[model samples]
Target: NGASRFGRLRQTLAGVSEKMLTQTLRTLERDGLVRRTVYPEVPPHVEYELTALGQTLREPLKALTEWSVVHIEEVITARGEYDDRAERTR
Candidate 1:
């Protein structure tokens, strides 16, 4: 589907609260990166989708996400080494 509800997005992100998700979505929509559509129904149904500009950013973001996943261990190890060096200097 081109659009997704707040709950779906929250679940997809895992551990994101309703308020945080709402704020993030609102920010994205306000910045012209996301489109929010509200449907008139028995209960108001809202959906969010990436705008064209947002779509353009997907690939690079995905690549960055993948890189982080791959390098997380190395990053953690480097941090520990740096911390140890700093402690030794003190």
Candidate 2:
């Protein structure tokens, strides 16, 4: 299903705190990148799904993730070199 429940999303995205996840979802919704639906049940149930605009970002985001993974070692090495230089200067 395109839509997903809050709990399901939390389970899928491990290590994210409930509060942070909620806040992130709210931010995305406010940005018009995500649509939120609240069901009128005994206990309210909420679902979130990507808006058309948000869906358009999927490929670019994926590419960025792949690029980060590929260049992670380079980034770490650069950071280490920078830190070493700063330490020598100090």
* TM-scores for the candidates: 0.84, 0.84
Error of 1 at 64 (Å): 0.2
- Write candidate 2's Cα lDDT for 5-28 as tens digits: 999999999999999999999999
Q: What TM-score does prediction 1 earn?
A: 0.84
Task: For model 2, give the RMSD to the true fold.
Answer: 1.8
Query: Which residue pairs clash in candidate 1?
Result: none
Error of 1 at 11 (Å): 0.8
Highest lDDT model number: 2
Clashes of 2: 0
Clashing pairs in 2: none
